[model samples]
Target: MTDIIIDGGTLTASRQDRVVRGLLLPYREECRSNIGRFSFAPGVVEIPQDLTGMSLNIEHERERVVGAVTELRETPAGILATFSIAKTPAGDAALSDIEAGRRVHLSAEVAGVKVKDGKGIAGSLFAAGLVEKPAFPSATLLAAEDTSDDEDDPQGGDDTETTHSESEYVDEDGNVWRMVVDTETETDGDTTTTTTTVVEEVTENPDETTDTEEEEDPMPATLAAKAKTPTPPRGRTRQRPSIADDLPTLYATVAQARAGDQQALTLLAALTDTKISGTGALPGAGVLQESWQGQLWQGKSYDRKYINQGTLGTNISAAGKSGFKMARGTKASPKTKLGGDWAGNKTELPTGTANAEKFGSTLARWAFAGDIAREFFDLPGGAELIEAMFRLIAEDYAIWSDEKALATFLKLAGAPVAPKTYPSEYNDSLGMLLQGILAVKRAKDEPSFAIVNSTAYEQLLYTPHEKVPEFVSFDITTELRGTADAGKVYVVEAADSYFVDADDDPLVDEGEPAVLVGAKAGVEFDELGEVPFTIDALEIAKGGVDRATHGYLQTFEIRPESFVLIGSAPVVGG
Candidate 1:
């Protein structure tokens, strides 16, 4: 015989025959019913002595048949049997039918002997092998008994509670078999007393057994004790203040008012009026008052008496009145106050000395004209003009011995002499004139000629001339009123135009107008079209031939004027 432990319990079987017989009986009955044959109830039938091994056959109603068997066991009570079963079919119909909770029948056989209802028979045999029954509390019965005790006690004494607590039990399998809690309350004089008792049943593994099951570590005694105690009274959680809940209709009313509903506004006004009456002041009243009295009223006229008369309009009216009075009191002609008449009449004003003083002022104004012109035109020639004017004055002073003449010359030259070397009044006037000239020049696309001088001419002419290569080496000639000396008049004969090419010939007709070559690495021509040439040499053939030679052969030829070549080298004879 072999001993076997069931799930947390023990059993025994003595022989293989008994084990097989015990397991197959239930399945045999199931097969009989499934095949539509005689129904059979499985019972304690002895295993056939000829049996070798156990087998099960499951037959689906309209499908196929399948089966499996538990491994044979020998225990003190009988064979302890456990196994799984499934369906066999060409399709998955048997499995699908089983999963859908359809009933299936299974048959069991040991060797040549068949048993009925094997599953039920085996389950009963396994149950009979347990050495002891598992103990568990009946929760419903316990609760009912406690209620009955409380009812019996009426006032509820501590003795009944203690008796309920002491009836708890625990087992060695870590299962709580029973637990009870009891409370009693007593009052005397001005004091009230309450007592509570709790009992729990706990199970732990035996010391001789190795505990494969995990144990929950005990909580700290204080913590466990605290957990068993009742909680103290506390007020309910506070609710958050919700704008929507407190003022349910406020948002909707605002939306309606915005849609031009006057009822909402009227309601709001009534509410405000009621609040104002209760408090003697409206909310935001100061803001409303300021908005109406200061902002809104100030934006519009309250009365015509306080309306503004603009400063410009008043000034214009005063000016008109003064103009009218002056027109009536004086003659129709506008008179020059300095003794020059409006009519063709010259007044007998101050003579020589007075005239000289007046003339001096005029000359001073004129002398500053150059500075004014330079500033107005934005030209560097302002200083040049002033210098020229001063030079003229100095020359005049040297020629004329009279102080008055010298003074007059200085005035006309616009060079202030003495006390004010540069006149402040003239300086301001010059600045204004300079601005005006610059404005005119910008609009007209023409240079201001107000302060022309040699430096100015040189800048305008030569500066631009440098941009045109043809004019770079040209001896420009202009007619002179005096000397005709070769050095002074005609230094060397040359055209203000020239050709540019890789060779001296310029690869163009000699009679053609000069073509300008751009700074880009290619030669361009106005009359002939683009020339395919490189600047290999430049030659000055004075009073002779200008030509180019390739190797020993003449490639091009040209006639020459007074020779001068500024760039490249001279080509030998062609």
Candidate 2:
């Protein structure tokens, strides 16, 4: 059994806001903890000045950080903080437990503690945890209702009250107060709130008031009246149209709908209650992908340029200029007379030079074709099932493109770039990236982008390094974890780099930016014959093929001198 602590602690969590806010330590309130009786005063315990990255875990598990402390302040209640929960599964579960009136205790993991005379003194809160049973029983988690979710909402648009709940609290004087808030809304958009707080004498057993269960229920009159209203019987009202009934029909005709089947198209129109086009072209991947930009990877690869052909040449001229120089020494400066013939003392300047390099790009064809049995369309949820399949294929394609681009970048670099080692004071991932950027700057190029695996990026987010200039942009993708090692950072000068779609030329009159005038990725086209070609073979008798063929033609160019690859990217994957 875990020891419990009760030191006038208080905590509240708001699932809608994704935040857990409460008193961390009860100042001047003595509490019995697992380590015996301990309490804190204003100056007894020291906390981090900035609680920016403090982890909030579960059951004191160091590895399962579910949230981070976003706000903290010292108050009469001891230390108060607002923790923003992460969107991970554990985080969601913890918040749900809190909202559902479970796992109501919070435990503080303090470090550097010096216990003197049964009191903890001079310690820092290293982190906090959400536990089923905490050493401090008063550190209970309360469901904080969003007042804005009620009427009295300042937004004024909706008069309908959205939420109603009751909560209890223990004041410093040990008075138990039950708070009931009633929000009434009218059709005219008027909002009002009635709050009633009933105080009760401190009972012999504080657990009766502190525990969420076995507590007195102070029902608000307004809420009681609303609850007393008889609920209408289910299904007596007219039902709204739902697409569930037509799912089978839609699935059966989905492929034919894309192939311009009149019967299939008509059924789909009636099912969806909207007219679909007769052009034989159902919504392509673009429809589902539009919300994520042209291609998922391209959104992150912003430093892109376009070219029409597979081969291109670039010329880099030498920086130094050639010019005639006169003798500069005091003795030889005036040796040549103005009117004299060409003299031997005149010095000739070296000739300027430039280097030209031609590079060719080859198109890599990637196609995703998924086949579903013809009978699948007749099954429930087949439409969604097929879409999910294609979605996975699309995601795989995105990862492949991302890895391919990283590989191309690494290949252009020819060798791993080592940033100038920084002093111990500036030793961090962000510092390394800064040094890498400096290296690129020394090459007469500007470092505009940095690419790192998601793991490295997360470290960069918390690294205590000097502020990076606004011009330098950093991006993270999981694919980089495979291409570039998780701990590696790749800083590059990609302003002039381009992703070239060499398939077709741009229309000069369209006024499209030259950078965007090319065939984008995620394109679907038929084979030499109609896509999902009808097979006269016996396999057709089993069930017709349900296939989607998607392919794109594109290549990219990153000049050898335009990028600097920093950190370790193990050459392992194909």
Candidate 3:
């Protein structure tokens, strides 16, 4: 009987003569026999088939089975095997050839085969796709291998045992088995020795098997590859709705408002009240003058008339002892009189005075009045009124001083003028006073004092006197008018005129006789005499040409006076 020794962990078988039959065989038949509950560890497994004295060649180009065969078993039906295959050209080709029903035969004289746990035959055969159905039974079983001194034996002689607490499997013989081996190597001299030990448990029961799935990798998605698109950010929009469709109505409403429609004011008031607070007093408050105006008028109390008037109104005169005496005596007299008269006569005076007194009173009341009074009026205008009164006083003093200067100048100049009468000329002191008053008024009215003729006063002061012109006359004779061609040219004799000066020397005794020439062009003479002088042809031609008709000539001379040339030239075409 010829026994097929499969010393390698697993082996594959196929019928060489019938490829279809071999292909039809189950994969379990491809496993080695007597592999009994095998284990894969850190090292390799070797199975040697004795082909002594027999020539045998195995085609292992198919790569279905390569690298370490994880498990090998024999059953009643067929061989069962599993391998951890390597991706190599020869292994792939061997698997392919086996799957195609290529058969490998052992030697005729060869005995049964035995597999060892070693690096050489086990690693090479398994890497060559001789095994089927590879598996990793446990973490320990993942590194199991065989190493023994059995050179001739097909299987590696024996396996080195490992010490570990957890056993991966238990066989029918009650021996605990491990699945994985961790190998370590030591070399002494030229020989190298390797030792491997099982490290973890393994299980074959399908129900008890633990599935360890790898973690999911996080790969970045491209912008184009993402499934969902991102939404754009929200933008701000105007609160009001567009009036495009009702533009005409809107324009009509605006026009009506501009024309002072009452409804517009009502609408504005409503909108303002709702959208803006404290706008009710705006219209009335805008028209109200500042309290400072009143305060400024109060400052004018320093004036003699204003003070006198204030005294008269508030003072009580004692007709009996020593002329008139103040009711409050000398000390309080001025204060009482000024204050009382300011209060009483304020309404009778000019608006400026009344405003000033009102401002002063407002300030005084705020500063001196009881807290009860302050609370009653709320004192809102107190500070403003005080400021106004001070301004009014300052402005009034300025006006009074200017007027006083004018009065003094007028008295010195002997003008018995009343305060009401204003001077017109800038030379008068009264005029300066009026100017000051007018300037202040203009400043208040125009704010900028812009409409003043700045040079008027200077021009009035430096006006120049007009000079009188000297009168003289000359006579011309009919013989002096010598004629040339009527339309072309003519010559007028030059006439000389002179004015006698009493201071001038006699003509015979004169240093150089004063030459008198005619004002008309092209005529010259030494002295003014009754004699006729010759004129040029060009002058005669110029004199004959009408300025209106010739367009370029301006004037002509006719002895005594210059004449304006007029009349049009005859049209040649017409």
Candidate 4:
């Protein structure tokens, strides 16, 4: 009780790449499709050959489609006929179905057919309804048969033979006065006569010569399997892949890492953009940090040893006084002198190892669900997710480094910076900072950069300071540095200035916002390993459940003496 078509009609894929449907097909083959149920078998139907390249209203709608027969194959079920919608004005309506992966019924004019397996003339095929989708064929899969078998006959070529020829002639008057004559003369008493006949047929190639049962037999285990094209290969069509059925998958990078080979590591780098150097205890959050100059320090701290700014006192003291008289040849107490005094007095280096407060971050924000990890790996945005994680790790490292430096700064700035005397109260911040920068410039032998809060910067902006005329507000990374007034004052953001309380709430009054100053080498950022900033993941046993611990080890230092802040510095773990 569905719409029954006696001839050319729809087919259903047995799996992804195969289908068995045709006119005069065998069995009561049924298929599920969006177009509804459409059955095809031979009936008393007649299809005209003239309609082979013509259009038909297979849509069963207003528009008619030009149906072009793609192939008429002898299938295991029966004759499998496949057709495509021609590119025409009316065919567009039918093509929409094909493009949408929707099946359409084939309206065929079957004629002069009697039985289910009987063959007859099929006039035109029109796609009518919708159905499930199927896969297209590869070149080798469509191969039907081979036909490179035509060879020349043995005795059909040029060869000499001994024979005689005779002829009879009659007048146009129809009087049988036949005259007989020998047409061949004796070639040394031997003559040759040869006759050849050849017959060939001009076939339209309609018959399905290749009877493919079911694609092909699987390759045996004994032989190496390969693809082969038929000597008379079937035509291969280019069909786009179906996006709906495409399923993405996750690469087993984590599993591959177990191998620990160069190739495995390389693949991990390509996927995660990071290579594992070694494994150790992930550093805990603390005050001690490595500086940009790659040295260990606590806060805005530095190291200095007793170095003779100039030469100290001599290795021996003057053998004067009572010692000279009592002991003439004895070694005297050695002492070094300051610039204009005795050698005994010594002074410490201006800068010494001031602090070693631990400062770092522990990456603990993790979605403990393993399913989340799987999702990140399997989703289309997996690469982006991984990249974002890497960036956050770097940012976190920089942030903690900055905080440590700020803490050092708060300690170094005088107890009473005693608001400097200036024309405007607000504008005084600029003058105060300029005085600090001038000192840093003298010590470091180069001008330094500064960072302050937006409010402080606004104060500087209102300053009537005329010396910084060629000024512009821009970041250091801006490309047009040459055009900027290098001698003028500028500010950078103190990335780690904010502090939070135990509740993870930003503290309203930890201290005044900070202003940091640094030269290229003024701040030391000690790196612990070759790759200080790295991605780390591990499985931790917590509460009897396995959880992944993803963290970073970015060890760096920032000198506190280089920065100035208005508020108290945030302590570690704040």
Tens digit per residue, CA lDDT, model 2, 1-574: 1112232233467777787765566554445432334466666666787777788876666698999988655543356556899998998998888777676555666655554654556667657767665333334324445454544536755455433333455444444433322333343434343322211112323543543333432222322212322221221111111112233443454466457665532210001112334454466445544352322333442222111111222221122112222332234243323332444566554333333334433454566554567655667756666655666666655555444554454445444444455666643556556665566567665444454433344555554524544544444344321122323323322221222213222111121111110011211111122211222222376675646544333443534555555544234341
* Per-residue lDDT of model 4, residues 60-135, tens digit only: 3324444455444332223334455455664564555543446433333322212122122222232222222211
In order of listing, the candidates' clash counts read: 26, 5, 57, 59
Error of 3 at 447 (Å): 99
List residue ranges in candidate 2 displaced over 4 A. Answer: 1-357, 378-380, 454-458, 465-539, 568-574
Worst 10 residues of 4 by lDDT: 177-186
TM-score of each: 0.12, 0.29, 0.15, 0.28
Clashing pairs in 2: 4-135, 5-135, 5-136, 5-137, 305-498
Q: Tens digit of lDDT per residue, candidate 1, span 335-419?
A: 3333333443674553221111111011111111121232422455455554444444433332222222212211222211111
Q: Rank candidates, TM-score, best first.
A: 2, 4, 3, 1
Select the stronger candidate by lDDT from 3 and 4. Answer: 4
How well does candidate 4 score on lDDT at residue 239? 15
> 1 or 2: which has the higher lDDT?
2
Scored by lDDT, model 1 comes in at 0.25
- RMSD of candidates 1 onward, in order: 39.1, 32.4, 44.2, 26.0
Candidate 3 residues 302-380, lDDT tens each? 3331111011111112221122222332432323333333346546642221111111010000011111222212356
Worst 10 residues of 3 by lDDT: 357-366
Give model 3 RMSD, 1 decimal: 44.2
What TM-score quantifies how close candidate 2 is to the native fold? 0.29
